[model samples]
Target: MIKNIIILFIAFLSVTDLFSQEKPFWNDIQKFKESDRFNPPVQKAIVFIGSSSFAMWHDVQDYFPGYTIINRSFGGSTLPDVTGYLNDIVFPYHPKQVVIYCGDNDLANSDTITANEVLQRFKLLFQKIRKQLPSISIVYVSIKPSPSRKHLMTKAAQANIMIQKYLKTQKNTSFVDVYHKMLNKNGSIRSDIFLQDELHMNAKGYAIWKQAILPYLKK
Candidate 1:
């Protein structure tokens, strides 16, 4: 009986490990929850949700003074990841506005994924948000022209255009176009704005974002 029980326990451990591994960024979400439990977030603040771009912006609050900001971004995340974690990252905050910076990783993640798919995923997220918080403002930061992901620029542009068009018909929705602004006069991506990795941004890139996004924030 002891040997049988030990075997069952080992099997249970294996299953638990597998389940945790299956959930991408689970630890990140858990950490957010833990932080919220102790510190508590400011209700009705502007919440930023998405991938590494927003996550890397550790100083996002400093960029906009007098605006309450709650950033729940997890690095290396895709659109679906954000959608999957909406309960944790978004709704609970009862936010006044939501600023998103995603869909970049969705395209870069797989060749099989298309721009239209990115738009669809975004719509799903939008629909869910509207269903739960009907009156809240929504802002989408257009996927940046990352120097490292230059090959995927066409796909990114297509996704951006479609998302921008879709948001036009929705009330209280603003699409901030940072993609074109990040490009040079010759229409090339500005390499100076990116970090050494060419994937993430440095201060200059965030500065551009601050300008583009500031006007849309709720006072």
Candidate 2:
């Protein structure tokens, strides 16, 4: 009976591992890398990696023209997607800094993952990046609080707290708190900052982001 139980445990572990494999976001990564939106080869680059926020920020170069900035953003990508391809998409560029924005898609997609879990994945991704490129700096952009996703506001705030705390201990990691800046007097997202759907940002939103990020990029 003990031997039979051991065999069954092994079978169960295999099944669990199979179910744990993440859904593919590689197709979008592949397409983005091939598209005109991706930055060309550069020396001492600064990479921006994330979801639609990063993708939609079209004026990154205009904001930080002094450094070679590569925008490797794909719309609707979650943390797991960016974590999977960090080596190929980010490390090869030998960037001085990487600005990351993710997690909104994870919450929006009904993943039901806890705030700590999202923080853990961010830690894992940072570890992977460090293993390949030890000297590179990591700048984590706070997952902005959206009025449209007000139902998940608690989740977003909790995740930001975890991320902020995590950033404090790391050597070259920093948190960019765009959430507080985006809020209006009533604590809703500033409607003037976002586009039509109130999900993504407009030029004014990008301008605020540019001002917040310029100091770090100059460093």
Candidate 3:
């Protein structure tokens, strides 16, 4: 009986470890929360939230001069991750507007994640924000194309289409077509837009984003 009890305890710990690994980004969210406790963001500002794409936009304020924008992105985050920590990042700021760039990470995180699944997840997120921040102006930047993740581009493109269609039916929601814009004239991912990793965007890519996204932001 003693040996059986010990084995069960070890098994429980293993399961707990696996659970923790599944949500590794939780700690990153907590850190951001703790930071806010000290130097909180300006209320009613524009929040750029999502995965590494927004997290690494180190010069975002420079890109959008004279805008009250706060960057709360944690790298490798997914749509679910953003929704999971919305209380910390989104709700806390009392944002007047929001721009999101996610979904690619969800598709890249697993092979089984479908375009429809991503679309549904995004719809869920949209509904949640609407229920809470009814007057908020929200923009969804389409999943970008990448040289390294080109194999998944088709699904990402499909997800973008679904999201676009859905957003059209909603009020005060805009879909920035960054996906199509990121492609070259030949309909291929622009090699110059990405960094050395061939995954994340470079300054040129962000420039494209700035042009596409700026017009839609609340003035």
Stretch of 10 with least lDDT, candidate 2? 19-28
lDDT string for model 1 (83-158, tens) is: 9999999999999999999999999989999999999999999999999999999999999998899999999999
Ranking by lDDT: 1, 3, 2
lDDT of each prediction vs. the true structure? 0.95, 0.81, 0.90
lDDT of 3 by residue, 150-216 (tens): 9999999999999999999999999999888988788998898899999998899899999999999
* Segments in model 2 whose C-alpha atoms lie over 4 Å from true places: 1-23, 32-40
By TM-score, how accurate is candidate 3? Answer: 0.88
| Candidate 2 per-residue C-alpha lDDT over 1-219 given as tens digits, one digit per residue, 9 for 90 to 100 | 999999999999887566545446655665656763464677567889989999888777887776778888878888888888886578767888888999888888885788888888788888888788787788988898776777777888899999999889888888888888898888877888888887898889988888777777734
Over the full model, what C-alpha lDDT does candidate 2 score relative to the true structure? Answer: 0.81
Better of 1 and 3 by TM-score: 1
Query: Against the true structure, what is each candidate's TM-score?
Result: 0.92, 0.83, 0.88
Best by lDDT: 1
Number of clashing residue pairs in every model? Answer: 0, 0, 0
Better of 1 and 3 by lDDT: 1
